[model samples]
Target: MSADIVFSDATRLAELIRTRQVSPVEVVQAHLDRIAAVDPKVNAIVTIAEGALSAAKEAEAAIMAGRELGPLHGVPFTAKDSIDTAGVMTQRGSPIFKGRVPDTDATSVARMKKAGGILLAKTNLPEFSYWIESDNLLSGRSNNPWDLDRTPGGSSGGESAAIAAGMSPLGLGTDLAISIRGPAAQTGIVSLKATHGRVPMTGIWPRAPRRFWHVGPMARSIRDLALAFSQLAGPDGLDAFATSAVPFDAGVGTVPDRKLKVGWMVGPGFGPIDTEVAATVKAAAEALKNEGHHVEEVHIPALERDFALDVFNKLHVMEMKPAFREATAGHEDQMYTMAKTMLSLPDTSMEDYIAAEQAAERLRDGYATYFRDYDVLLTPVLPVPAHKHGITELVVNGETVDLTYLQGATVPLNVTGLPGLSMRFGTSREGMPINVQLVGRWQAETTILHAAAVLEGVSTVRGRHPSI
Candidate 1:
């Protein structure tokens, strides 16, 4: 019963709660049990909120009293530790704030709770949400459920792992570069990095390089992503970067009615993608074409230039350094590895920073122009599948590449503030999940979600789940 309960989608759980088929207390306890059963091996959920059962009881009483219900009433969800949850440990997976608890929830968390979702736990992440792997001195490393020795992808790795392993149905996660999409790709779940400013970052950590940061949903289904996105998006008035949000409807986005124009890729533009990954993406495009949408192999040469990754790397280090230094100025010894990493970065000239911003503007304009002709852009979220945990290098098409290339296909979206999603397409020979990325123009999340939902409908592997 616990296994079945944990695997049910958030929407389904909501329906059950509303219909009195299952009490919210039953739903929440089932997940708490699931977390206890698997979290030690996966290390995904770092802290279970103390009053989860009390909250569930309240939700149950509300239903019995015939009170109005929210969209996610009684559905349990997790959030990355980097996102604040009032009265819950929001340590950001760093020792610097080991006992940290916030008075107010992050805007996204607050909105989710407002919509009737329960915050049952906080998931793990790299220190300060800084790395591409989920490991830090605070909570240790999070392992992929499909392969214990491999990574699930990071920053949002724990959130992805939790969803993949059925510890939570859906959750909130932040993406600076590949934090959301990369982990989802590796763990065989789904995640969205919405258009910049579509979701607020009011109570999240490492709120530097404000322009590139995005908060979004990581879930087991695109429908859940749409549900969570609707609740999380919109200007909160606290975060200046969170501009106006467009309305979202999962019913509309998942309907398979639109004939989309999708541009598929496997060029030098996306860095050294594995041949298999490229084929999987192309296959998705072909499947969509067969479904009556236009599909073409295209290239935007700007993405191929070294400057695409270089510019992001420079700005990320520059913006993150000052904030991290300020946060840990007096206790350098207590700083996590990633916080110390900022000190190791080469100093960037003000001219370089200016050049990077200009380049970013050009990238944004280029993507905007490209979107005029294409409805969605499809690529591999990562050049390769999840690899051994703690490894510093990865093999992309037989060539060992720097670990940073893991976020290759992803950062360009941040550079342009486009909305991008990662959905599992297939699996590697080792049974590791491989996912393709669907990127849409700014404020066009529905467009990509529609296309991805269609692809998900036709996917042979969409029904597969990790055996944790």
Candidate 2:
């Protein structure tokens, strides 16, 4: 009963509660119990929401009273500590902000609650939500459920770990570069990083580089991603960037009338990728072709000319350092590795900064040109599967590369402000999860979500979860 409750996706859980086959209180309690059982091993949870059970009881009362319920009513969802949650400790994974509680929930959190989701808990993250691993002085590091020694992958790592370990059925995670999708890939879960401004980053921290930042849902199923995106999309009136009046449909498995053109690539632009990971990308392309879509291997020349990672570093370092300087001022003692690293890096020269801005435009233009002909693009989410915690370097295909190269395949979407979804399609020889990325044009989330659901239907790894 506990396994069934904990592993069920948000969509299924909502159905069960709505039908009264399972009480809201029971659903919430089962998750709380699962957290108590596994969080110590995973360290995914930083602070449990004290009001969670009470909220569940209230949801139960509404059902008993025949009151209308929200779509997620009774379903429990977690948010990364970086995302503000009213009355919950959102410490931002640093001692400088320890014990701090926001007076209001982030737009993302409030919307999840508005749809009937219960606030389950706050999960761990890197300091100031920077870096590629979940470790920080505040809540410590999060370990992969698949292999406790391997990291879950960063800033949003704890959110990914919680869902992977059955501690949370759904979660909200922020992405700047690889944070959201990369962690989902590492954990064998599914997460969406919608177009830059599609989902507002209103209440997440480190808004200095807001252009590349995004907030999206992480879940065990592709349908949950679609459902959460439908609820979370549109302008909130506060975030100027989120002023898109675009219409979104939770169009899971909606087959298109014409054959969708998909291009898959693992190299030349994204740097070296593991052979196994590369093979997984090919397999996904093959599966799509088998399903009768127009599939072919293709590359964008823009990516080759202006490497997205280099552009991001040049732009973000200039934009982000000021925020770090402000936050860590006089509290340098509490600063973590990522904060210190950011401070140590030299500022981008005025000439380099302007060049990076132009390069960013080029990258965006590159994707725009490709999307003109192709409806979807497929690529590896990470060069390799989850690696041992604290690894500062990785050897991909015999060439030693900086650990940041793991962001190689993911940062392009951030630079281009394009929508991308991460879902597991294969497993490494070491049994770690390998996920493929599905990308679409700006404001074309419906297309990628549709593609994701179709690919999910044929995934050999569908329904697989960590033994933990």
Candidate 3:
């Protein structure tokens, strides 16, 4: 019974609690017990919420009193440590701020709590949430539940690992470039990096390079993402970027009335991709094609001309370094590999930075042009599956590429402010999870999310979980 409660998606858990089939205490306790049993091995959880059971009891009292309840009344959720949670310690994965605690919840976290989601714990992350893997001197490291030796992906690595391991059913994660999507693919869960500015970034760390950073939900099912997004997508007034008042339709599983045009790609714009990963993208396209959508293989000329990863690197390094320098000022020894690397790289020349800005415009124009005909773009979330931790370089399709290539397919969405989601659609030969990215034009989250739900219906590995 505990296993069933822990593994159930947030939507189901909410329904079960709503109907009185399960008590709030049981639901929250199951997750707490699961975290206690599995977190030591995974190292995904950084701090367990001290008030979780207390909150759960309150939810139970509300139910017993026959009072109205919120959508997530009894459902437990976690947050990446980078997101502030009132009294909970949010160390930002660095010893520099070892016992830091915020006086208020991040907009995302507050919104989740507003909708009746109980904060269960805080997950780990790379130092200052800057790297592609979740390891830092503060939280040690987060290992993939599927294979202890491998990473679950990062900066949101701990959030992904927790959800994948059934430690938490749903959670909040922030992304800059590949953070959210890459980690989701690595862990076989589902996550949505909604249209930039759709969710506020208030109370999250490293405010530099703010335009590229995003906060969103990572969950075990597409429906949970839809529910979370519906609650999270309005303006918070605090984050000026989150001024989009667009209404998000939470009807994710419902079939759209119009037949959709979908385009799938694995290369040319994105760097070299593993054969298995490319096949998976094609497979997702085929699945959509089989479902009566018009699917085709296509390329954006702008992406080939100016790689998104290069554009992001040239622009963000200039924008991000000062923040890193400021945070690590007196505590230089506390800096991690990602921060040290950022501090060491030569500043982006003013001339090159201006050029990259132009390149970014072109890439956005290219995607805008493509979206004139296609409703959705499908791509591999990662060039390869979850890799062993601490490895620097990866060889893909006979080409040796820097570890940063993992962001090749994802950074473009950040550059263009397009909405994208990651959901598992395939399994690697070594048994690691493989995911395909579903991208939509700016503010078209509903379209991609609905498409993801349709694909979820036909997924061969739908209910599979790590055996940790």
Q: If scored against the real structure, what TM-score would every candidate get?
A: 0.97, 0.99, 0.99
What C-alpha lDDT, on a 0 to 100 scale, does residue 410 get in candidate 2? Answer: 97
Q: Which candidate wins on lDDT?
A: 3
Per-residue lDDT, model 1, residue 150, is 92
How does candidate 2 score on lDDT? 0.93
Q: Model 3 off-target regions past 4 Å? A: 252-256
Candidate 1 local Cα displacement, residue 360, angstroms: 1.3
Overall local distance difference test of candidate 1: 0.88
User: How many clashes in each structure?
Assistant: 0, 1, 0
In model 3, where is the ten-residue run with the lowest total lDDT?
Answer: 248-257
List the candidate 1 regions with Cα displacement exceeding 4 Å: 253-258
What clash pairs does model 1 have? none
lDDT of 3 by residue, 1-468 (tens): 999998999999999999999999999999989998999999999999899999999999999999988888889999999999999999999999999989999999999999999999999999999999999998899999999999999989999999999999999999999999999999999999999999999999987899999999999899999999999998988899999977886884334579899999987989999999999999999999999999999998999999999999999999998898889999998888888988999998999999999999999999999999999999999999999999999999889999999999999999999999999999999999999999998888888988999999999999899999
State which candidate, 2 or 3, has the greater lDDT. Answer: 3
* lDDT by residue (tens digit), candidate 2, 1-468: 778999999999999999999998999999999999999999999999999999999999999999999889999999999999999989999999989999999999999999999999999999998989999997888999999999999979999999999999999999999999999999999999998888888888989899989999999999999899888998999999999988776874334578899999997899899999999999999999999999999999999999899999999999998899999999999888889999999989999999999999999999999989999999999999999998899999999999999999999999989999999999999999999999998888888888888899998889887888
- The sequence of per-residue lDDT tens digits that candidate 1 reaches over residues 31-134 is 98888888899999999999899999999999999999999999999999999999998998877899999999999999999999999999999988889999
lDDT of each: 0.88, 0.93, 0.94
Clashing pairs in 2: 72-116
